[model samples]
Target chain A: MELSLATRTVAEHTVLEVGGEVDVYTAPRLRERLVELVDAGARNVIVDLAGVEFLDSTGLGVLVGAMKRLRVANGTFGLVCSKEPLLKIFRITALDQVFPIYSSVEAATGDGTGSGPTS
Target chain B: MATVRLSFSPAPVHVRTARLVGVAVARRAGVAEELLDEVRLAIGEACTRAVALHNQYGLADLVTVEMSDSDSYAVRVIDHAPLEASVGLTKLPPDELADESLTDDALTTGVGFALLAGFVDDLVVRPVEDGSGTEVRMVWPVQRR
Candidate 1:
């Protein structure tokens, strides 16, 4: 129910840490934030979903929308999700392949020399 | 052979009520926690949609939720809103894959009927025989990974 956004710059990439539940009631806020970043010329975006407790279809739709927007601009969007429940949902929906998923925010942001994508 | 039935005003509160009842039933039926979450989310979506459409037409009526356990757990959510108000899964158009404007967060993230269809294994939405309200029946199989 609570949403928090934190921004960090890593090498030329912009990482956005999203925490909280993303549902129909909260997805609009996330979309607005993504739009703002895209408009600001952030081409490389990483969404850190480590703190996300729940994700619904509404949340998935927002992510898909963001991916489409960034793809059109020749940009990229990646995700960092460690929660098993959330990961299961993404895997079942086959969205795990739609977005590049990393194990941690550091890997997602490619911070200086961190672990690379987990298979 | 356990069933729980209740009636409440068709509003946001009903959504929460349905979720609570779903969790309770899943627990009593010894369903797994992960599957319990799935059932709760599915029921929440169905009841919320029914309530929203029912309220739009000034059809303030009691929303009846029935949770029954048989070979598998099932929920029947009925609202006094006319059947015409109910939106069918087949009637909903696919997501506009090519429209930029359609990517609006609200349009993309709103709990559409499509998501409900994907979540529940057995879902049926139809009019009551009395032609008064919409009835949504959802079944959750007992064995789930």
Candidate 2:
């Protein structure tokens, strides 16, 4: 299936909601979208993965690249992913330590008491 | 023994088809429900890696994927890229992977075998004998009725 992307401002943070399968075929779109957001001067971004059904290494790579880009801009990047399968991927890659992952968009945009982002 | 074979042009679009077919076969082969996600992810990674290798070397060959349930559920993704592509990335030992985690180059290029190693307990990457390219084989235990 094709990847779906929607961007909205929430609590002063840009929330990009992603849906559908993210694989080699569809990851570039996500990458492009992330680039657009950063180039548009979105400082704080939270990618909501709650609607995402599948994610692969290519998708993960896109997310990692986005995080690094935002970090370079001295902005904050976080992920809202609570699916066990998707969480398992992050855990396996040890990316769970790299991104500030939240259970929901509210939690991600909430007070900065969630899991801290790593360098 | 039931087996499914898929051969597709080394294109990114075909990787999803390979994953879907691989997971369907794995389920019919009696692979546990909980491990289906792992199977799907592993298959996707293997196919994606093969496609990347082929594209990198400008090869127009087809990537072949085979899944069989003769014993444990096993899947193999074969690519026709140059031999060196396989040599440089496929054979790293586990101990050396700590330094390879999430490198910028690795993420932009290929996630490589380290991520696949995390998903499949039984994983092997080796050069195709009597030919160029690499064969990535992954296995997961299954219950036979």
Please list the Cα RMSD from the true structure of every candidate, rounded to 1 decimal place: 4.6, 3.3
Model 1 stretches astray by more than 4 angstroms = A111-119, B1-17, B51-64, B79-119, B132-134, B141-145
lDDT of 1: 0.72
**Poorest 10 consecutive residues of model 1 chain B by lDDT?**
B89-98
- Model 2: per-residue Cα lDDT over A1-82, one tens digit each: 6799999999889999999999889999999999999999999999999999999878887888888788789998999988
Candidate that would win on TM-score: 2
* B22-70: candidate 2 lDDT, tens digit per residue: 9999999999999998899889988888898888889999999999998
Cand. 1 TM to true fold: 0.71
Fraction of native A-B contacts kept, per candidate: 0.12, 0.42
TM-scores of chain A across the candidates, in order, are 0.91, 0.93
Q: Give all TM-scores, in the order shown.
A: 0.71, 0.90
What does candidate 2 score on TM? 0.90
Q: Between which residue pairs do clashes occur in model 1? A: none
Off by over 4 Å in 2: A113-119, B90-105, B108-112
DockQ value for model 1 = 0.23
